[model samples]
Target: MDDSQKRETQQRLQSCLPQIHEIHSICQTPSITFGVVHNGEVIFKHSIGHRDAQQTLPANDETIYMIGSCSKMFTSAAVGILVDEGKLSWTDPIRKYVPEFDPVDDPRIGQEADIIDCLRHSTGLSPPSMLCLGPGGTILTDEEDLIPLLNVMPAVDGEGKERFNREWIYNNYVVGLVALIVQRVSGQRFADFVRGRILDPLGMRRTAVRRSDLGGDGNVAAPCVKKSNGRFHGLSDESWPCEEYTPLLAATGMRSCLNDMLTWCIAVLDAERSENDSSYQSQVPNNPLKQMTRVRRGYWTRPADDPEFSKDAAYGMGWFRADIPSSMLSAFSGNGFSREKEYRLHLQHILGKGSEAAPFQVVGHTGGMRGSIFSVFTFPETQSAIVTMTNGRDFGDASDFTAQLLIQALFDMKPTLDLASWARTEAQLAGSNYQKHIERPWRENRHLGDLERDPLLYVGDYRSFNGRFTLSIGGVADGWSTNLSVKFNHRNASECPLVFYRKDVYSFYQVDEDKWKIQQIGAREYKQMLLKFQVDEGGNSVEGLWWQWDADTKPAWFENVRNRNSTQKGAPFLVKSYSG
Candidate 1:
């Protein structure tokens, strides 16, 4: 394309800025920062709304927000770097790298597990839910604790291995294990490896793998969670510290701004096209880029949660093949982000379909943490990318809404639905579902008074049979608030605080969904549990605890041990004495 054509396209795109801004407002997001990259340059960048609810701080193109699982791409790329060096192969048995790592107790499954299995989410392991909850589900924040955490996870039932491989199930624990493999093989902290090898090479100074790395000088956006009433509540903290979950860091602990993210996307777009002048190729090899972008596993059916996408949709190494409108792809090419001949050939070679002939084929990833939502889509056919970051969760529809509108405005497409009304209805439904677990009907029927036993009566340590978990009962912020905190295998300071609700029932709201982080807003809110303590005949000593996860009255019980070394009746009983 000539310089004159490029100028005309840029002018046309700039004219759509007003409609794009309106889309941000319509989503009711507290703040959204966006950037578009065309050809090799960042053609457009802007922000909307305040970083804080007080509206004191306006968000800008450089505001840092948690990218969550989007960090998976960087981690996958790091593995690619090692692969390029011949340090590892995608088919290498993970046990060869992280020798101590064994996903499940079943020896046959462990023996067959390889690096590809971790990236593809087909380890034949149990679902992420079973490995990430209660005593088995403690989040491993410290790198040194990874081996011990893996040791305790209940083995995947061997009988179900056949069924597990038949479907693609997302698992963060496996990704965390992948980070451990990277760390063990590279001899560097996972975060440090990514920064030195990936971030620094890309000139992404504002991008980091840990909260502390964001530094004090940058315009870091305050993380915010959306309430049921359509208002956003800014989180008290700015970044999710990587120290909290060392291995999980590879899965979801990166902080980045719009400027750096756009640069990363551009680098990816350029390298995928195999640009001879591209610095991305100079830093990271072509095989890794092709591996990360091409489909690794195809789904049998369209993702139920995202029905809009085609059933042909599938996951690549760390990215996925997303189907967008072909018209949008053409509009991007007209604006100067035209796909080079090399990129078209590469896409065709990997997809096994002439992706260039198809109207819509984009590769990217989406991520969400407690207070942030992030998305990046790079169109290899058009040589363009779109990045949307929002502080409000609102079921992550904020980013989705922004991406759709940006495409329509830039591509001159007509609206097909009442998007505003649709967004409001979806948000309302998600919000209602999120609040269900907290507002149980049982709460209203029960007496909202103090426990029959003195709060101090329950203050002590309770340990599981294998000594993997110990629950510490204590007073919170004076005698007014009662709390229970769990310590995993006597390492990593206690988390998962259970606050007093009514009588013996303690309510704990899980902030970190870890694996199921992308579920609909309502499904997320239901990750609550009610812990009801049982008393002895004297009513002075706590005897057991009942875990009430669902609304059903039936709950799993952990009977308190009367003697430290004695075997207790009931399932996986907890002793009152500390094991260590």
Candidate 2:
């Protein structure tokens, strides 16, 4: 983490990018965004790539990206809002507010997963899946209504995680549901409560859930459009078709630009500073709901996502334990981006422990999507925070990298990565591909003289055998091309191509031995995906076979037939999502 070290790391990161770009060639678009915050101020901000290959736009600090599970922080904060009101308690059985909620697993463990467990993910629950179609099962995204799904999802995984926790369930779905419980008890809609209690008070003007409420998505960053073949379609105007903030308002769906997010971090940092000087409870301007703060004895009492993080400050209602030195007295929270097949991710993290500057519990959270990366750091003791937001999935690991870099820079230490050397390596790789003529750009690769020019077409009603996927062609685009993406029931944006490895089989072919053979090229490097094709009459279309990772789907299937313009349905019922 020194200057020379940071420069070298930067060089390596930059160098590894072209090879990374090759991965994007098949994994769909690549957009890289980066920013840094130090000493509670914006030190640097930059966007490394295009939003799409359209070459029309570039992401900026204000561009909003869905933080995915990072929304859990918001849900957790909402819980704190309720605690501020004294209407809810961390130890209270969720049933106190959500009486209808019943553990579908061991009856003995009923009500054991309390508010803390929900926020810290100790419920001993596993990701759910009952819908039929692919292999393994898919992790239920928070936007997907889950309460009823929880009841119906076969409780095969059982509770009892590594620690005194539940199975590997999607924690945010439940957390959001619990947030709903808070709303119901407090008589305040979750969004309103969060805004009035946390955001508005903290000056997070752009942090909002409703698009209509956020006043027109507001300079939002677009999600990536992965092709059936696993390459980034580059940056496109295509959005997540569904309301970014509806469905349940629990784990995902909220939006805020890097700048606003940074302000939020500063607010949390400042609040910590403010609370220490005066009475912690007396500062509320008007208490529609009470807010409380306490440092739990342990970092994480139930589960351990990774053992090394054992010393983690652990969960405090909604906040996460950051890895920054406790002597620094700070905390951090955020999610990481994963353009994986089943989940919409940004492997978020939080780190905090009072720092000497303000000297109180400081918290930091980070989120990334597509290819952008962002960080929000706050020193609760000083009530000061800094935020950095970027756009790109390739930059998923950049937040931590950038953070370490910024800290080093502020302290005037050696850097960890070198941009010049890194850029050179990337250029070499890109140049090699260009020389080999594999850089098809968009024009040459997609436009195949005619739609039927190729005999092996992948067109059909494809579904995952694991009971987790349902995808069809939307329509034909750019002439010889038909627009294809996952079906609506597939979760998240529903339009993103669900990349399934092994179970995933969408591929391109080149002439070989007088017959077309699987191209054995452009398969995802970091993610999982597959390809397959079928023929109809003399014409051929493509149908992709991918898995829903969120679900336990591994054995997927393909069916029916059409020219990539078909639709399908499944069991009907109403369920709640995690928007609370």
Among the numbered candidates, top lDDT falls to 1
The reply for model 1, stretches above 4 Å from the true place, is 4-8, 124-141, 151-163, 226-232, 275-311, 325-357, 410-418, 441-457, 475-505, 509-527, 532-563, 566-580
Instruction: For candidate 1, write residues 1-580 as lDDT tens digits.
Output: 4788667657756665565566566556688888777665677788888888666889998788878778888877888778768887888887787676654445644666777677777655433332233332234233554554454343434353342355565666677788888877889888888878888877888997766677887477766655545556665442254544655677877889999998888767766566434444333332233333332233222242224322345566667664654222221111111123322221211221222334466676778666677888777766778888887764425775566555554444444223454445445554543335434533453455765445666666554424434455555555665455544224333244655667776655443433122222222223235567777777767876665322221233455545354554223422233221
Tell me each candidate's RMSD, in Å, in order.
Answer: 8.8, 11.4
State the lDDT of candidate 2 residue by residue for 1-580, as single tens digits. 4568556534543444444343333222344444544335544455545555354677676666666545656676666666666777877877777666665544433556577766666665544422311211122233334554444333344233233263433444566667677668868767666666666766667665655545564455655433334444433323321233232455654667677666555444444434455755433343222233442223353333334532335555445554443321122322212212232221121122123332234355555333344555554432344444434333124344344334434333322233233223333342233223433431243333333332223433454322233455343354665544444345433333322122123322222211110111222211123233333454433433333233332223344334233453322211212110
Off by over 4 Å in 2: 1-53, 129-145, 152-170, 213-218, 225-248, 277-292, 295-318, 323-362, 370-372, 379-386, 413-580
* Top of the candidates by TM-score: 1
**How does residue 278 of candidate 2 score in lDDT?**
72
| Deviation of model 1 at 400, angstroms | 1.3
Residue 509, candidate 1: Cα error in Å is 5.6
Candidate 1: worst-modelled 10 consecutive residues by lDDT = 329-338
C-alpha lDDT score of every prediction, in listed order: 0.58, 0.43
